[model samples]
Target: MNHNVILTCAVTGAGDTTAKSPHVPVTPKQIADDCIAAARAGASVAHIHVRDPETGTISHSVEHFREVMQRVREADVDIVMNITAGGGGDWIPDAADPTRGGPGSDIQTPRQRHEPVGELLPELCTLDCGSLNFGDMVYVNPADWLREHARLVQAAGVKPELECFDLGHVWFARQLQQEGLIDGDPLYQLCLGIPWGAEADTETLLAMRNRLPHDAHWAAFGIGRHQMPMAAQAVLLGGHARVGLEDNLYLEKGVLATNAQLVEKAASLFENLGARVMTPAETRAHLALRDPNTGHVVEKAIETTAGGAA
Candidate 1:
């Protein structure tokens, strides 16, 4: 029943989805352009992930990140940038030798994973709370690693968007809050519908939401076909919504869609449900997020029913 909501468009994810849809952005300019387009289409934040332009494979290069950041920053549109700090955790053991990593294994130290976020200084960064069976491979984010990642985000003075893929992750996120590792008011993203993780259904979403901190500002999203439905559900359950090419690549059955199209559809749903999509400035004040580039608080108090709901 929350009337005010923040819509985030995840431009591109670190998945093998580029070939599946022609609309999926791969190059730095494409990613940045989509970020701007999504903002114009009503998304307040852009959750970004870079990829190798030539191969369309996920990349962690600071050079790629810099190009994308520079384009988005120099753009005239105002969009809150949220960089992923959850990379370098993909581990696939080799079939021939279980002791060695397979072709898809992409693991890095905690600092290596946080390097881009640390150097780029985006307004928000993600911290995956726990390890989970991510489809055929296992995505590892052990307790120790998570603790260290949280500390790194805290030290950067950027908001950590605690990404909880399961109910246990929600519990661990609360633990991080208790341990004082997460700074400022807790900001969480209830990541649903990933393989072997939480299901993308009302029962699961409500169960996870019930366990969140009472005052936490949170958003939720579902992958693939459940994307728009879960976004509408999030609004009904008093939370913000996220949509983009990252989680879904279609406007309808057999229809390819761009990031802006996805955000526009989500915004339509929000308005139809009696909720107004929040702008970047409003989200900044509502979440008390900092300016990543300038390293200063970006809050502007305004009078509205949804001003401080989260």
Candidate 2:
């Protein structure tokens, strides 16, 4: 097992989980507060997604994103903010007309998907590596779309956390890295345990992990009840862990959890497994992330000196 690791809390997701759990943050302020709470609870990073406050549904509004970013920055916590560039890809075909998008379909151009990330320029952002049968609907991320998205993310100078839902997604991500679309050391988020995707099991995680680029920095997360187990699995396999309401709503069976509660639980698991949860500063250095506050890369020289002194 890796002794030192970066723990990330996916504060909220763009899924239909608002009504399932009251703890899922809907408004910009609520999401920001929970992200700050996650940071206080020992998460080095906060994976953020915005929603329509009144409707309690997924949103891709720039204003909503701006509000969340402002609040989190105002809190002045050291959490590495990771915005979602994986929006506007949900496709639920209409029963009446298959060609026409249904009520829930939220497709967008690559530029529309990258708007918030390009404007806000967080420390990190997600790029869903490929399309898959995401439950009833198809989450469409075609090759051309992914290539354009990767190029946009690179131009923004924001590190893309290549989100791989299956083994083939991992292969495609490696292809992107090979094409020089991603900058710095490529980062990957091995997303497992969703409908029709990679299973949340040791064998599946290992299979996907093995396919990653040799020098890639990666993390893994599982949904629902498998969250903690998959996190432990990831850590044992020498990768990082991700936990929050986005991936799991319950702290335990039938027990609803806040973002901080989930993060605290993940931290305890990491500690018990003999892995040290990294601080935000340390995670920034480890991931080579830019300083969100100043919009500049953290100086390697300064980080090295600080580590030596410590």
Candidate 3:
């Protein structure tokens, strides 16, 4: 295993996991606080997704994003922000009238999906590369829509993290890179253990990693029980790792975990494997990420002096 590795903490996701775990942050303030705690626990990057404060449902509101970003900035944490552009693509077909739109369908144009990213202008954003059966409903993002999103993210000067749920999605990501849609070194997030996407295991991870572009910067994450194991597997395979309550809520078999706990476990796993976890400033330098407001590459010298074992 390599000595240098980056750790990303996904603070909150768009999934409907609030009902299952009370620790999942619903409001913007709670989410921001959770992100700050994760940074303090040794997370270099934070993947954020906002939810409605009143109902705990997933939301793409720019106002929600603005509040979270403002609070995090005020806290003066060095964590890199990575917002989600993967919403507004769910479609639940009408059972009675198959051609008509269903009750739960939340389909929107590519422009709508990217509105939050345009407004927030975070350092990193996700670009789901392909569509698949996301449980019962179809999560739709056709090639044309993805192409448009790629162009938009590039124009906004935000790095796009190619989110690949399956092998085909990896191919599409490479195609987009070759077409000059994504800028700089392409970054990928290999999402495993979903219903209709790739499964979580050693063979699947190895196959997917082998298929990625040689120069690509990539991270892999697994959902539920596979989360910690996948973190160890990813580091052993010479790739980065991501973890949070969004993917798994349990610290043990019956013990619920906070977002910071998950990050701490991931950091410890890296150390157990003889790898040194990089800080946020080190991660920014490693990935060549620039500050969104300043338009300058983030220097490692500006990081806080606090240090601890990963």
Q: Write the per-residue lDDT of candidate 2 for residues 194-262, one digit (tens) a residue.
A: 999999999999888777766778899999999999999998988888999998999999899999999
Query: Compared with the true structure, what per-residue lDDT tens digits does model 3 show for residues 127-241?
Result: 9999999889889999999999999998988889999999899989999999999877788889999998989998998888888776777789999999999888887877888
Task: Give model 1 RMSD, 1 decimal.
Answer: 2.3
Descending-TM-score candidate ranking: 1, 2, 3
Per-residue CA lDDT of model 1 for 1-310, tens digit only, reads 6788889999999999998998899999999999989988988999999999999998999888888889988988888889998999998999999888999999988999999998988888889999999999999899999999889989988889999999999999999999999876788899999999999999999888888887677789999999999999988887888999999889999999999999989998888988999889888877777865566787656332221221
Q: What is the lDDT of candidate 3?
A: 0.86
Evaluated at residue 3, the lDDT of candidate 1 is 82
- lDDT of each structure? 0.88, 0.88, 0.86
| Candidate 1 residue pairs in clash (backbone atoms < 3 Å) | none
| Model 3 TM | 0.94
Which window of ten consecutive residues has the lowest lDDT sum in model 1?
301-310
* Candidate 2: Cα lDDT at 166: 90
Clashes of each: 0, 0, 0
What value does the lDDT take at residue 216 in candidate 2?
78
lDDT at 273, model 1 = 84
